[model samples]
Target: MKLRERLEGKRMLLTGVTGFVGEALLHRILRDLPDTHVVALVRRKGSLSGRSRMEQVLNKPIFEQVRERYAGDLSALLDARVTVLEGDLSDVPALPNDLDIVIHCAGDVSFDPPINQAFQTNVLGTEQLLRRILDSGSNAHYVHVSTAYVSGRRRGAIPEGPVEHDADWRTEAHWGLAMRDRIEETSRAPGVLAKLRRAAERDHLRAGPITSAQDTERRRKEWVDKKLVEAGGERARSLGWTDVYTFTKALGERVVEEVGAPLPVTIMRPSIIESALETPFPGWIEGFKMAEPLILAYGRGELPEFPASPDSQCDVVPVDHVVNATLAAASVLPEPGTPAYFQVTSGARNPLIFARLFDLIREYFDKNPFDMGERGAVRLPIWRFPGGERVERTLVLGERAHKAADFLVTHAPRGDRVRKLARELDQQQRRLDFLRRYHDLYRAYLETELVFTDDNTWALFHGLDPEDQREFSFDITTFDWHYYLVELHCPAVTESMRKYDVIRRRRGRSAPQVAKQLPQGEGIVAAFDMDGTLLSSNVVETYLWLRMPELDGQGRAREVGALLRRMPGFLNAERKDRGRFLRAVYRRYAGADFQELERLVDDSLSQHVLERVSAAALRRVREHRAAGHRTVLITGAIRPLTRPLEPLFDEIIAADLAIDDRGRCTGFLTRPPLVGEARAAWLRRFALQNDFDLAKSYAYADSHSDLPMLRAVGRPVAVSPDVTLWREARKGRWPVEDWKTSSSVSRLTLPGANGGSSS
Candidate 1:
């Protein structure tokens, strides 16, 4: 009989039906091999019954063709031909014993999942399934779906066969046990307990001061879990695997060999599976898979750079190709002995290089850039693939820059320009760190020259009759990379992204009037610093020195006296470590009612500070506002102080104190204070979001602390004369206008003055 004829009337037990490949395979079998009965394993999810989940799975777009052929009555079709087994591979529940074929497709696929969770789903789960099949005395031909990368870091032509090194199952078991023991031991260790205590203290300051024994245990467990994940990554890298998923999947393959030795077994190793080429529907994908996230990130101008070598051969195969190869392998099994291995990969024949893939992505997105609503279109960033070595160098540079920035931000004055640069540098450093870690995880694969050989796969296909070959053709050589990627893959990925809100497609004219009028381009915004430029006295210091005493009513004298005594120490701290001092001062207000604090700050600002607003500085602000430019109050001052001045500016960006559910101050900021280079970063984001023209915008400040914000705009003006500001403004040839009552109305025209319009 032919391959389809052989599969007809056969009872096949399929695992991971909800997975990408499994869903495709299920569709193929049900659609083509009409007589075959399938037994699918589905685990119960929260609130949803197992059968209900399976039903939902069948309704997915992957099964669109199947649904259409059956007129959307998937339940009726499944009821007649498939058995929804409601249990997980981790469980010891009874499996469908009376089976002709068993396809194990379920395995952990997460790049960096929790260590124990990866082990349980990928390794232990496979072992349990194998045990269930063997112990039931079922004469099923087991077809285990694994990955070609399970060969790990082997170079050159990786053959379609068993893994290179012999798996030590006992050693793996012992290591797992030791890891479990370590987890339990470290969760209660003194060092861990101390870390928990520090974390608890921070939590108390942020939220309410409440911590239970259970809360402490939860924190301890979280720490242990994080450590376990780190250990798993380290272990996987040491053993030549990319991540826990691959490492554990390799272990699962070993277990399958040991446990299913007596049964007829076939191991089908497929490469990176993309969307379906010619099955189900063209470009049918579920969630984002493989390198799609990177693709999306690049298209949206969010990705920094591609770290891999552009010329590296991406060993990718269509999902349908793998499914066909899998069914073909199962149909004609080898003599009852060691498991038959067939690599279903595309590298040997239809190899698509990373450079080519990236080109296709660029080509697709170039035509259709992602829209960010009123923020305008994301400018397609320069596509940089500096390769591995340059990426490492970039990472090192970023780290150094970050360290320097951190030090400056900590030691520099509260509202200094150096602090803003530091914060911006710090953000760059974080992105670099993330990229470095990502590079480390996948560096081996990118560097590897491995081309997975599919000799066995081709031989199996050649053994079949012409009719059978035509029925289930998995010829890797026939795959057209350009057609598959450009015409189908890229478009499909973009469509899916839009569906999931990963990209916001431009809405039609029917969109809301408010959204339409949000402004998009060529509009200017003027950012003004409050403390030194607009106000004569520092708002934060003034609040502490004068207003805070009023808030303490009866203890006014004691509190004011205490603040005065601490003033010298705070000043010393300001010169030494400003960040720490800022945090310390904020911590004093923890647990204070937010509403009461707001009222006090409002009273203080209007009564004492607002009258002190410089006349010249106010003129500059009014000029920008009168010119229909967006006026922004960018300050290092507290939000409550800025609130009273909100009417003067269209947007107020400042340090906001964290408030808990009870409307009490949490002694911490809701986010990092927008000061220093951070202010500049915020402006850039604000300009993007509000469609402002930063190049045409203006900035006015008294202190050199507003350097970043000033540098960001086209017209940067020094409002008042501070020694540092005067010197820097003179050196850089930036406009200088003293806003003091002494020089009010008369603007200082320096040597380079060409009698330009001041505003």
Candidate 2:
């Protein structure tokens, strides 16, 4: 019988219609078997209904061919033959009584998920689904989609049959689910809490006590997640499986055998599914799959050497082939109370060696290298196929060297040169981390010795009519490995990478135009951070500009030497306590005449301070003032240095220096410095006293020390932020902007100044 004819006029219920393989199968069935009615079971995402999500999925590129065939009236076709059900496998909804087939394609696919999470979805979820089907009283043939890796760590030929395991599925499921509570209980032990609290204190030293406690709780949750992942991996390995995913999948198969009674069952296991061959379109893939990450890493010159033998068989099948095999398996109903097994694989029939695959990737990259902007075209690295132990040793040594370099850079004197070197070191560390992660995740798969056999799958393909075989062929022997790797798969991955790059660039360039226009009235305020956000100069630079001119050549040399000797301590203090660092810095002004400093600030306002101000920041401040929003300059720089810029803002809250009776600086602050949590607290109280609505206010900062202040406002903008602040901004989806210094401008300006620009 033809494949389509066997499936025609049937009512099918399909789960995981939103995933890659499930979506492809649904498209194939809808396009080929027009008379068939399909009930698509999909889980609702955040704020999006399952039906709405399905509409989005149908609009993907994978469904373009079918959409065109229906003349862009895919909605009409869906209305006629498709039924979208909002449900999940853990809690199965009502099943159709007249169902002809049930394709179970939904399960957790992550390799190292938490033990309970994997068991709940892959094992218990499957059991629940089977029981629901039985309750519906529909004698539908159940086809469960699984993975070939369920054969586990056995290093030999794997047959198309049930996995041999002594562990009972019920006991494994119960223990896995119970492990979560045990882990959570252990996480609250005194020793664990003490360790996490110490780490959090170090991380949030400048943010105050409340922020440190919050960080401790966050770290505790992270520790629990890490422990769960480790426990899952260990248990999976104990059961002779590579990871939790395959172990739970094996248990899922056991569920099918034990729970699916008196009903025909078929198990379809596909190996390492990749991009499509020729079905919907060439080089069509939804997202990055198993091999694409490593491929792209190699193309980008990030992976120096891999841990795999040259003779190892790399079993990879296209998604279209898997989809076709699944449909074919679904078309043929097995005998009642009997389970049929089919392994959709390419290892036994036409094996592609690791060396050959590497060569093809190298050749493709050599012809069309990745464009890495200023770094020039990427040069492919020669794969020596080093031993796993040796590769691991190299990574460890590289990490050690990277840490030493980071320490040296951190303690070095702060300047443009040192900052540049620090950025370079950060980039290299990220690349090194990527390499380590890739090796840890994929080393086992790359060096595997097991090969899956597909005798039953081949027989099913041969049983099809000649025309049907031509239309739905999954013949691995006829596939062109070179063409697929070089022309289709690699290019698809590259396009996906390019799209991601475009998104990142857009994020970096996005402006705060929306935030500026959102609120009005005097109760709305705009807060600005001074040192790095609004000006290129810092407290040290401003102090130097005032104090350096007072000394001659030898005195100036002594002053610079003193500052150099104290730089390390200053940096340490700044990292741990920004307020303390400001106090220490202000001490350098002792014994200097306050009147003389004021005169010097007036003389150098245009050349030193005003020239360092960012034009973008100046414009944003004016725009806020023009809209009747109060403008506040909150900085740690001393009041003397900021006095000239008072015309630009309604309020300037800066550090004030204590003076002796003779007007000489007393080397102490009149009040506590406004920084970190203290600054956030001041902002809150100021808002309450002035009737300002903080939820309608904006705050701009550049350093992680200002995280509390940024969080206190409704709209936070990170202006040329540091690494830690940048990471926080990305997580919060806060807007980031790079403000460059306006070197040509020698005056400060505002919207409603009495004399226009201030000098």
Candidate 3:
């Protein structure tokens, strides 16, 4: 019988209609089997109703043919032929009395999900659905969609049959489901909490106590999740499976055999399903799947080498082929109390090795290369197919070196040069992290030697009528690997990525601009960080510029040599306690004539301070002043250094050094340094005293140590931020900008001045 003839008047219930294969299957059934009634089981998401979600799915490009056939009245057709069920496999809803088939396609496809999540969706959910089918008393053919990798860790030809195992499904399900609570309980132990808390403090050092506490809790949950993933993977490997996903799926197959007895069951397993071939248009795909990330990374020149043996069999099938095979399997009802198995894969028939696949990908990318930002078209790398172990070792060593470089760059003095280096390192780190993640996830599958035998599937295909075969063909023997990948799949994936890039560009352009959207009022204050925000020069540089001029060239050389010798200690002290670092740096001014120093700073203001000021930052300050908003300069630099820029701001809150009766410097701060929590506290007091609304005020800073100050205001911009501040800004979704020093201004040299100042 033809597939449509068998399923013409069938009442079917389908799960996983929102996923890649599930969505394509749904489109095929609705378009081809018009007379069939389908119950689409979908879980409600947030505020969207199940019916609305299904409508969204039907509106996708895969359903374009269906939409055209129905003359845009797809909604009316859906009303007549489809019923949207607002539930999942875990909680099966009431089924129609005369249901003919139940297609369970939903599953967690993640390789290393938390154990509890894996079992709840894959094993127990299947058990619940099977039990529901038994209770419904409908003699429906149950089609269980599973992966071909369920043969787990086995080599050679894998036949279409039950997986050999020594463990009980019930016991495995019990342990997997109960692991979450155990991991959560362990995460709350005193030692664990302390460790997590310390890490959180280091990450969110200047983000205040409340923010740090919140981060600690977030870290605790992440730790629990990580432990759960580790435990699940360990359990899977112990039971001879590659990962938790395959292990739970194997258990789910056991559920179909044991709990789903007396009901006609057909288990259909497909291997590494990719883009569509013909049905619902060629090259149709949803989100990025198993192999797309690796392919895209290679095309982008981010991945340098492939990590699989050249001759290893890569068993891949198109989504449309899988969909057709599923429909074909649904057509044949098995004998009562006996389940049939079909492995819908191409490995045993026309196999495509890893080498050929890589060649095809490279060919496609060579013709139409991926855009590499400033580098234009990416030049594809020559893959040596180095073994997985070698590639992994190289990535590990690179990551360790990256960490050491990161440490050195982070502790370097806060300046434009260091900031640029930090940004470059951040980009490299992200790329390396991406390579590591995909390598770990796909290494086993790419290197596996198992070739799934699809004898049962081919037999079933041969039994179909010629016309039916023409209409719903899934013959892997006739599948052209070259045309499908180079002509269809690669183009489709790159097009999708291009669309995403467009959306990202639009979002970036739409980000909030602080200067253009400032409110006008005295209560609205605009706060700016002096060192890296307004001026490219830091406290150390400003001090050297002022103090070095007062001494001869020998004194200047001696001062710089001493500062370099103590630089590491200063950076260490700054990391441990900001106030101590400030005190130590200011002690160099002890015994200096305060009046002479003040005069020198005033004389050299235009050369040292004004020349280094960022033009964009100065314009923003002027805009705030013009709008009648109070502008404040908050800095850790001493008060004398800020005297030059005093005219731009209404208030200057900087460090003050103690002066003796004769105007000699005491080098001791009269009050604690305004940094971290102290800066936030002082801002709150000032806002209260001046009747300003902190919620309506604006603050800007570049260093991570100014995070508390940034959080204290409504509008906080990160100006040419360091690595730590950049991460915090991204996480908080705060505005980030790179304000360069005024380009038109030249570096001024004072007559008889010695070496360059340190920054």
The candidate that wins on lDDT is 3
**CA lDDT, candidate 3, residue 606:** 48
Runs with alpha carbons beyond 4 Å of true place in candidate 1: 68-75, 196-222, 372-386, 399-434, 465-468, 499-565, 568-759
lDDT-better candidate, 1 vs 2 = 2
TM-score of 2: 0.86
Better of 1 and 2 by TM-score: 2
lDDT of candidate model 1 versus the reference:
0.73
lDDT of 2 at 352: 91
Which ranges in model 2 have alpha carbons more than 4 Å from their true place?
A: 64-75, 410-419, 498-524, 531-571, 583-628, 637-641, 656-671, 685-702, 713-759
Question: How well is each residue in 1-759 modelled by candidate 3, as lDDT tens digits?
Answer: 778889999999999999998898898998889888898889999999899899898888767777777687768867877899898877888766677999999999989899999999999999998888888889889999999999999999899999999878899889987888898999999999999999887767555566678889999999989999999998988988989999999999999999888899999999999998887788988888888988888888888987899999988899988999999999998987789999999889889999999999999999988664556888888989989999999999989999999989876765568867877888899989898887877788879988899999999999999998888989998878999999999998889777776677666533355657567787888888898889876666777777777777788889989999989898777776677888899999999888877777776554567778888888889999998888999889988888889899999999998899999999898898888777888889999999999898888888888888888898888988877887677768788888888675444433123323332
lDDT of 3 at 151: 93
* Alpha-carbon TM-score of each model against the true structure: 0.66, 0.86, 0.88
Q: Please provide, for model 1 over 290-312, each residue's C-alpha lDDT reduced to its tens digit, 9 standing for 90 to 100.
A: 76766787777766666777788
The lDDT of each candidate is 0.73, 0.85, 0.85
Candidate 2 per-residue C-alpha lDDT over 643-744 given as tens digits, one digit per residue, 9 for 90 to 100: 767888999999999999999999998999999998899999999999999888999988878999999998888887766666577668788777888646
After the best TM-score superposition of candidate 2, give how far the Cα of residue 57 lies from its true spot, in angstroms: 2.1
